[model samples]
Target: MGIATVNPATGETLKIFEPLSAEEIEVKLALGEATFKQYRKISLEQRSQWLKAAADILERDQRKFGEIMTLEMGKPIKSAIAEVNKCALVCRYYADHAADFLKDVPVTTDGSRSFIRYQPMGIILAVMPWNYPFWQVFRFAAPALMAGNVGILKHASNVPQSALAIEAILTEAGFPAGAFQTLLIGASQVESIMKDDRVKAATLTGSEPAGASLAATAGKQIKKTVLELGGSDPFIVLESADIEAAATTAVTARLLNNGQSCIAAKRFILVESVADRFEQLLVEKFQALKVGDPMLEDTDIGPLATPSMLLEISQQVQETVTKGGKILTGGQVISDRPGNFYPPTILTDIPVDSPGYSDEFFGPVALLFRVKDIDEAIELANSTIFGLGASGWTNDPAQQERLIEEIEAGCVFINGMVKSDPRLPFGGIKRSGYGRELSIQGMQEFLNVKTVWIK
Candidate 1:
């Protein structure tokens, strides 16, 4: 199948491109390796300058780039614009702080002057997802490039245009010719690229299967890999939570990115004392959401990125209902729509053993559960095999501290929504995948942490 832009809103194909042949792929690999030789020798200051320039380009052309993102994957035009701005923020952040983050740290060992040095690890293969197309790639690109490591981006096939656009941005920003290049290849082609001797390490932000495949391949080759995969994050609202605020934020968090984000609140765990009120408020908020064309200014939710996503989400809903779950609203697909649009769905009384309980609802669906107390809330939240992120809403200081200490996720939010930021580490625990992204931990993910000893 050729890589094509199929507008998820109307299911129309706008453009297509054939995958690169073996010879072409080899040539690009060679270029990436060659680029790294000279690129890694550059100073952090020089790399930062180029990175900031890329950020400038992103800001200058945010509208155009944002439109491309919306057209390709069906995110709201407004959110797409925000995604672009966020990408720029990450770029500028790394550009300004990379020198400090990657600085050599002196160690007083053996009474001699020795220090640990941070270095780049040749060419990094980035296998990224399409959910937040630009943000995902830039988060990796900003830090990897700033560390003097060349990157070969094998972005999700559906977002080919975004991939090429990013490559263009880096080049125009004064990066060396092959410092960052988009490989217009298929998933079947990724392993061979990873096996290449010149490709030092890899990073992936995608599904569990994709992460497993890449991690296994990188392992067999004895190369390092960082995987940020799926999440079925819990959004816990205790009795002491600001019920109105928690309910409002819950709707926005669940419906974010049309519910395609890995970090979007998937499970709602409400304490029993206030569960009735919380559920009532949540239903009102969900019903009031405006789902329509993503390009429209007032649209609150957009279609799933692809038809397959719609089908998967619908199936999850059906399975949950069959297993004795109660649908409070939006149990069916929207009628008379050309795109993959599913109404925002809310299911309550879903059995803990139901399929939906363990599955990651990939679209705009929220699973509600009521627990007797904070301890039970924590129990239900930690039941999932995936632990990418979690959010807890409560005014009790002791409860908030306990939740933070007990929640099984890479990142935890107390009385607030969970979001990825350039200033904090983001990733997951358990089967959600290993390694962190964003912040100081993110920048260090693909770096060479070398320790020096003098005797």
Candidate 2:
């Protein structure tokens, strides 16, 4: 797709943006490198003040930003507003803690004095996604800017307005124009950007193919890169779990962002003893969801982010059914809708070879599997090629401990849903992608750790 905002709710093209030409991209890149030289000399206190002001602006105009997000990406207005607020929280978080995170660490050594200094790497490129446009970019920009590194955002093509809005917010909050910039560019232009020596390390959050392509290209340059890719996260409920609570949270976990989240639970594993009950609850809840315009206050579900997304999800569900997976609730697309709307769906009795068994269903669809015990639960949970996150429910201490230690995912929530927090390290292993974002680890991803010693 080209750089433009096409409303996913009504299939309306609200705005169009031209891709930045090669010359324009060069200007921004030169500015980023030049700004980094001066920006890194600015006091941490000054950077902190600017970032804190960003938080203030985000809070002041959250509703306006939220509408931009919803109009571009089809997330509900309430959730979109909440996402903007989260952007503010992350700005404040890094603004308050970045100085401590980047402080020189005194090392005990044979030399008279030794320490490690954290320093900025110039022009960090952020390849963000459309799912959580504002949150994803801020999580990267807040720390990068606070650490005195400039940023260049190559956001998803479909959310051009959201991308520009982010650049505007940062600039309005007293950041120099070069400190952060949005490039209205397509996927084809990314390789050229990475090839530029001025652009240092890079970070991306998107599909496996996109992440792999970027990583491969960056690897050739011997440059550092962080990737947060696809996930088929499992949600397990054992015999001892609170069926009611697990069932309730399961719906939200599966349908968040219209079921477009990478960490949203995709596979539901239930102990045979509770499988029937949990399955019934899930079906009832799925059938009860309200699917309509995302801008409506009472709508529970909205359109998929794009028509291609809608088509891919429908094909996956159909293939699963053809492979012997039984649908307990929704099994077809809502043809009456003018936009990309798919109802909440539940697939059970899945064969091992079905898409429901292994593929990450990136829509409002849930795959249910029945296991005999905790051993089966863990085994089934770890069966997927993706291992981004897992949410397990159990009251037994031993079972909980086993789930925590045995589950092969980056994150395991014992009794709740899997969600990203600004204070915690977030990322995954295996096919889900590598490296980390958020927390102290994320702040240091693109920094140079220099060691100094004195005899």
Candidate 1, superposed: residue stretches over 4 Å from native: none
Candidate 2 structure quality by residue, lDDT tens digits, 342-448: 99999988998878888889999999999899999899999989989999999999999999999999999988999999899999999999899999999989899
TM-score for candidate 2:
0.99
Error of 1 at 324 (Å): 0.9
Number of clashing residue pairs, candidate 1: 0
Candidate 1 lDDT, 136-190, residue by residue in tens: 9999999999998999999998899999999999999999988999998899999
TM-score of 1: 0.98
**Cα RMSD to the true fold for all candidates:** 1.0, 0.8
Clashing pairs in 1: none
Q: State the weakest 10-residue window (summed lDDT) of model 2.
A: 328-337
TM-score of each: 0.98, 0.99
Quote the lDDT for 280 in model 2. 87
- Model 1 RMSD in angstroms: 1.0
